[model samples]
Target chain A: MSYDFMSVQQRYIEQIEAALEGAIGSEEETLYGVVQEAMRYSTLGGGKRLRGMLCLELCRLGCGEYERAVPFAAAIEMIHAYSLIHDDLPCMDNDELRRGKPSCHVRFGEANALLAGDALLTRAFEYALRECDYAAMGYERGVRGALTLAQCAGLDGMIGGQAIDLRFENTRQMTPEVLGTLHALKTGALIRAACLMGGIAGGMDEGQLELCEKYAAQIGLAFQIMDDILDVTATSEELGKPVGSDRSSGKTTYVVLYGVEESRKMAQECVQEAKKCLHDLHIEEPFLYDVAEMVISRTH
Target chain B: MSYDFMSVQQRYIEQIEAALEGAIGSEEETLYGVVQEAMRYSTLGGGKRLRGMLCLELCRLGCGEYERAVPFAAAIEMIHAYSLIHDDLPCMDNDELRRGKPSCHVRFGEANALLAGDALLTRAFEYALRECDYAAMGYERGVRGALTLAQCAGLDGMIGGQAIDLRFENTRQMTPEVLGTLHALKTGALIRAACLMGGIAGGMDEGQLELCEKYAAQIGLAFQIMDDILDVTATSEELGKPVGSDRSSGKTTYVVLYGVEESRKMAQECVQEAKKCLHDLHIEEPFLYDVAEMVISRTH
Candidate 1:
């Protein structure tokens, strides 16, 4: 009864990569050429494509048209890519490498990288809502999807988490409560949005959408806790960037406060909670349970 | 039969300023406090609110509910403020001042300023589409308005122009065609969006929306040309920043290429063309004509 996770994941990644490449136009010699190149370089370079997979898979679980969700899937990936680009800026985390390649700012120069991030974020919305005609996916779903992405990526969500992180860096102000809030807003929001958007696309009612969000929220925290553990235990080559960045930067993380063993236990508990939500929602898909397990199992 | 230009303008400014202030929440003591302060500091500092006025006025001309368009007006101004903040970043224009006050980075460190800009842009869309329920502004209008703002502010528009400007700065590669494309995308696209968004809110058909876009494009170019002329002729006290910045940065502008006298004449011609579009659309609003005239007539 086990699902073939590897092949399904590979197919999803291919679909996502193709959609992402197609989303950014192929005009490199034009006026906005360099920024476009930077965008393509950073977005198409490489990543786990976790958000896109979650979105597309959830949509399939909801029985929504897989083709209709492709743009949304690509859009979320673009948002995630832009965030990483900005997060690696000199003024931010200042990471020089991402996914074993020079970061966007390092490769494209600072100004172009900044504009590329801006362009990616803006174009994500443009691509997602481009087919907002009355006939295409219906206006309601389009608006809902757009709003979910915007709100999760916005002030009270990712950027807000970033501000908190920057302000509290090198300080002892990050308590467990603060850490929970920070991680929830920073990482959980987008993951929750991906789930909710997929649910919306699949015509899930409000209760079902809420269940998806709850499940996503649990996995999101688990994902971050696992990331912290990986940062501490994984080799620099495996992580593609320097390991222990959080410690070096004096930033607080789950593994910093609660050693690796405790963090891993916490991630397992979160995954278990996430699986419970899926069960409560009557979703018996083995992939759903497998993905929750994968959150804690991912090494990089 | 003439409208009271000063009085009408003052009222519009009041409405816009109030809407903008109301749009940004008052939560300065939270984790996101510093970034929110930076957003308010830069967004509420001071600007002419020209884009807001254009959008609101066009909406009125089309007989849409003034209250509904207020969010869109404030949203556009937020986008403008964010752009100015990023433009003034050290990696970008490196300007120290904006609106007679220290820039966002000077007031709030570099990272917070960057986050503030990102938050503002994301929240602009969130705020505009918050009421996308079927009973609200109608999903079609909401989608159209959101799409218009996103497309105009995105890769092929404002960000694209900024890339070209940055790439060609201090270089002799900025041909006339390049300059035209730059201004049209950087400046014209948003203005055109304002007009078209207003038309959409007012329930104008596609053809009428096209006329509003045409009108806006003409005035957008003229506005930029006039800005170039003022940079040469006006004082720092008048423009709220260094007057000869363009020339000193080795950035080519309309005045640099054609002289102030010729640029003024060109601006006037553009205004005339804009008026012709308005007339063709049968929009007898004198305020629209006066606003177009103000583009060329203002000293700063």
Candidate 2:
């Protein structure tokens, strides 16, 4: 079961980094500088870049080339980075640090940080709309992918999840169902979107898209549950954030609700189920398989 | 040349109020509830619905039907309301009160408020998309209208304006040029979007759409400058919130930078220019003419 996690991680990271560098451009306008800086500040600092990598990896696995999904991969990362920036605001998580550096608002004043997040979120779609090769795949697919990302990031999905999380904070107890709903939204929505965008970018058929959706859903949840476990088991140095910060914020976690052993078991099952969906896909990449495992094992 | 401002204001307000009542739906789902409440809080709280009225008035003046433009009028207001909700967040303007009521975040908590804003924004497009019949005109016109609204609300337009506003706050003494740039974004972008949306919604020709854009740009700046003036001259009772609040925040303003007399002159010029664009159109409605004047002259 053991795999070369380090090499796979490095390869995915390199691919995502290269894509991002190619996607962003230097334009000299007053407004462009503000937007470019905000986007760079939020995205350049490295976390796992897992969402971007997953998008690329899935595109490769589903099709043959990773380049086709570059816009979507970059877009997903922008969305994730913006969410992190907003989530760390003084009114929200209030953390001073992210990925071992000062959070966006701490580095760029609160107003710029807020604007940066908003700009990044909006720019993601603009990038998709303007840069995505609609001609190659036809306008309908491109428009659909852009619309999907918007819907997933907006009300019924990621934002809804954040709202629910905020509402549930400091409550005495939350049902497992409610916690699952929250995770599906706050974290799962974007992850699902990353995979779906990859599928759409790759021009996968409806059946393939469905398979990707199921696989993404499983890995997304498992990734989040692993985060819950790490909050308790890993140190701030290893996690690159204050350990048990979720608990301190009075937020519920899978580990807290289901216990560490059961949480781990559930995460394993999720990874397994996700893999099962890919069983018939004829995927050739060993790296994508390794990524699914890494999703469950990441400390941060 | 002074006219009956009070009656004109009342009539416009009444029109917008009735329109909004029909636009918002009462739904029980948590997501829908948030959207409905935010729309009501932001749109129905007794501030003059000048934006919506402008859309209606411009449609009439452009030789289009008010009935045909009503949905667009409401949609533009929804977009405006969403911007205001997000702008008032602790990370942005952090305003505690809006139109005499506790701001969306203050009353509903930050999470719900954020979701509400998001829902309203998404629903705006949904509203426009559904209204894409173009009545008996054509599908091309309907599609064009929807796309126009989307582009305006997206990064290149309203979102871009907000980005510039965020970047400029508390950092620099804004020049008149900078003030124009900011107002063009913060105010003119959406106003232009509203006019264009209404024109296209009513199947207006290219010439008409172009004329409406000019008209909207003029009144948009006029409206914003007047707002800046009232922020200094009007009291909380008149404005439905504390006046001079922008001054207290140390934000840049038209009046602060240009002085009251110059700002008024600029607004007057903008209105004149807007009217001149429509001189050859041969508009039928006198109300539309009154609105163009009233928009520049309003105190609160």
Score candidate 1 by TM-score against the native.
0.97
Candidate 1 lDDT, tens digit per residue, B12-69?
A: 8888788767777775578888888898998884787788888888777776455567
**What lDDT score is found at residue B119 in candidate 2?**
59
How many clashes in each structure? 0, 0
lDDT of 2 at A241: 74
Model 2 lDDT per residue over B5-28, tens place: 567557656766676666555554
Question: Pairs clashing in candidate 1?
Answer: none
Q: For candidate 2, lDDT tens digit of each residue in A137-238?
A: 565576667667777777677877887777777984778888988899889999889888888877889998998888888988999999999999998998
| Model 1, docking class | high
Per-candidate TM-score against the hidden true structure:
0.97, 0.84
Worst 10 residues of 1 chain B by lDDT: B131-140
Candidate 1 per-residue C-alpha lDDT over A1-300 given as tens digits, one digit per residue, 9 for 90 to 100: 456988888888999899898889775678779899999999994888888888888888776456667788888999999999999999998999999999999999999999999999988888888843336457778788888999899988888888888889999669999999999988988898788877777667888898999999999999999989999899999999999888887888998899999999999999999999988889876877888889888778
Listed per model, the TM-scores of chain A against the true chain A are 0.96, 0.92
Q: What is the DockQ of each candidate?
A: 0.88, 0.32
